[model samples]
Target: MFVLDANNPEALAECLKELNWLAADENIVTLTIPGAGNMNCVLRVDTGKRRFIIKQSRAYVEKYPQVAAPEERVVTEAAFYDKVREIPFLQGYMPRKIGVDVSNKLLAIEDLGPANDCTVLYNEGEQLSEETFTKLLEYLSGLHQQFMKNKVDDELENEEMRKLNHEHIFKYPFMVENGFDLDTIQEGLQSLALPFKNNSLLRQKVEVLGGLYLSKGKYLLHGDFYPGSWLQTEKGIKVIDPEFCFYGSREFDLAVFIAHLYLSGQKEDLIALVADKYEGFEQLNRSILNGFVGTEIMRRLIGLAQLPLEMNLERKKTLLDFASKLILNEKI
Candidate 1:
């Protein structure tokens, strides 16, 4: 079994040879870290001949070591790529799986060259074009529609990752006092936690949504569908990081997409347009969808997993208020 290390060129060279990614005479390879994801070690391996990405999961989060994660999540991620390969609409949008090292718990896949994550648009104060949003929504709707009522593969179910995600999205943000210091992320942010912890009605509403999130398994979902997971390239938009993929409500993915757009300061009309264009599963629950979106907005604003948004304190307060309204089943 060969283990890959981004820091050691010699080890990477040996790994390339072991994986047959390098010819015996071709030893030169370059490695670079690509993005800011917490869970896995993602490295881009460039041989003079070609380029590919090697991703491996750590037993604990790479960014926050105290938080434990399942290494088996890589197996589930590889399974997702395998499943999508067969689906006509989802074929090219995902990276092609090159190979998997189960003992090492690593996956190697095709690298979409020189693409930027959608988060860069928000971070740089660039606007998301309507065409991009339409394409994204259309892709998502097609995925949901294609897999609705279809048999979910037992290996692809990924219960462990789903439970882990549920805690982050549902339970952690509302904790009265977890060791997580929101103020460290930004001063005075801890004050926001008091209201979320003390308000029983708000807790009740969140708990209700949490229940729905746990029980509803209507369609296959790209569990973490935020801007960070979306990539823009000369070719088209490509979605990545489905370690959290699972059988869950289609509404969850839609809500997550909408919440990130709202936080990015996209126009309300544009947001409405994107929502209207998505033709999801029959009789989707608006309240539940709104509630999920509301929770995602609040969690990102004050929770442990934060986005790099360029918003002032006053604007954050306004978004918090709006999030509360959505959570309470009130129209925003």
Candidate 2:
């Protein structure tokens, strides 16, 4: 087990020096842990005076300087953070960016607390009760409403982002490389009563949904709004991790939330619950919410957030069978 050594004050001080943090000498502590970070080192540095998280992308040498400029995802995310800063709901949700070191592709932002907490939604799983559901829905509704109202005309920019994000992240090659076998997934499906005829159907559904969604245009998306992306505190639920942030179909965010709900074992009456809660909100229609749900489920089943309903093989088969039936028979 990898324990985060928060006691390493010397190492924290050295990291501050290396990153050129302009703070007076004070007791500094390192509070980052080992986990699944896509392409950055997430660190929490706390001085006696202030606390902040340092997000630094590991540098890669340009083998051919003319071929490609080193990608700056940190820079991209920082810019995105500014774009969503005006959102009152997200003000507490996102960590405030305080400093940047573009040379190292590093950024510093406000630290939430304890540096990190294990209260992520996914980790909570089926234990998430009615209270948790209420909190999650509230957060989702606020975020979706904000994005739906945001008017922006930069479609081309979002298209470019789609290329970098969806195409690259959800591409077939990555799935194969990541040890996910299409054949095995298909076989698992076949064992179910409502098995998919071919794996191609998955891709087909994604393409259809993607095409329909593109026509709807970009809205602010918390690209990774799964349960793990949220925090419940005394104030309210705080959403975090804007690293995967982008401008795209608002449904993408909704889909991830729905997926979390499903994984949390709230799949039985999901449609009714979502409809009741979402349609009751101002400026939102049942059609729009249902449309979002349909597109989101299709996207998550085949896209980057390929979350399984159950981990056990037999249970997975049963869940897939039920899911297939729902997708085929249900209106949403």
Candidate 3:
């Protein structure tokens, strides 16, 4: 029942000491938020001698406190780190798991200092470099191919978080009255989003994809794989924050990746590169991937989880129409 508070250094130090993550005499030099995060309480802890990250998932989301979430999500993230430790390639692209306090829902990880997340891509004029994209895909491809379970069991199911995500990604965005005002995000966005929300066929197809997202599959997926989870560090494109991960379709992961490319206004060639580089891309169910991709795009625009997209209303409408086509299989 211990809560993490960056404001209270005495309490944090005591908790860290009790968990053996910090020495009795280790003084906390400073505690600062590493970057923009939505799901969990994350802070960069500097002991003057060294630095690391401490993350905890509370009963509600860190960004939207009114929204409820699984408290043990950080534990699942820790498990993901443990699961991928043997994979040398994946290890290189992610922060190392240092320790975990399951009861308190706290985790300590190696700090990739001054390394900003790729969220800047969402801003104007910023682009996702081909090199970074390739490294990210390679990490994701390896994660799906390796470290897979034969049959979907209860391990790392993370159903609570999945259900929470299911609402935002599938159900909420399309609702005519989800209490979220899209126009607040943009002047004409709500009016533009109305057509998709009211489309019967589009809603039906999106519902089918939502079921697939909930269903268990053979491959382990990094549930939230957008640019937000990627870090552009000195080493390369280091991936972080797999709290929403589960044993699900690899298509969901790849679909989210491609969706962000389109959202960020990345060129068609870079978007097309996914099919060429992803291992077994041809073998995947293209229809399913397209559905997920379309849903991701729509949800990001119309749903509660808004991105810092520097796009105009006209562009959003175009993307919304394009997303509808992907959902309905009218377009690739």
Best by lDDT: 3
Residue 134 lDDT in candidate 1:
86
Q: Which regions of candidate 1 deviate over 4 angstroms?
A: 21-25, 150-155
Q: Mind giving the per-residue lDDT tens digits that candidate 1 earns over 163-240?
A: 777788888888887788888888888896678767788888988888777764858788888888889987899889
lDDT of each: 0.82, 0.52, 0.91
Candidates arranged by lDDT, highest first: 3, 1, 2
lDDT of 2 by residue, 201-273 (tens): 5445444544544544546666666655665555555666665655566655665566456555564665347
lDDT of 3 by residue, 1-332 (tens): 98888898778988898888898889788999999889998999999899999998899999999998989899999999999898887888889999999999999999987788888898887888788888888998999999678877888899999999999999999999989888788888888889899999999999999999999888989999998899878776789999999999999999999999999988899988998789889989989999999999999999999999999888888999899999999944
- Give the worst 10-residue stretch by lDDT in candidate 1: 148-157
Residue pairs clashing in model 2 are none
| lDDT winner between candidates 1 and 3 | 3
Candidate 2 runs further than 4 Å off? 1-21, 34-36, 58-71, 115-125, 147-152, 155-161, 168-179, 182-202, 212-218, 233-236, 267-271, 279-310, 325-332
In model 3, pairs of residues that clash are: none
Q: Comparing 2 and 3 by lDDT, which wins? A: 3
Looking at model 1, residue 135 earns an lDDT score of: 82
TM per model? 0.93, 0.69, 0.98
By TM-score, the candidates rank as 3, 1, 2
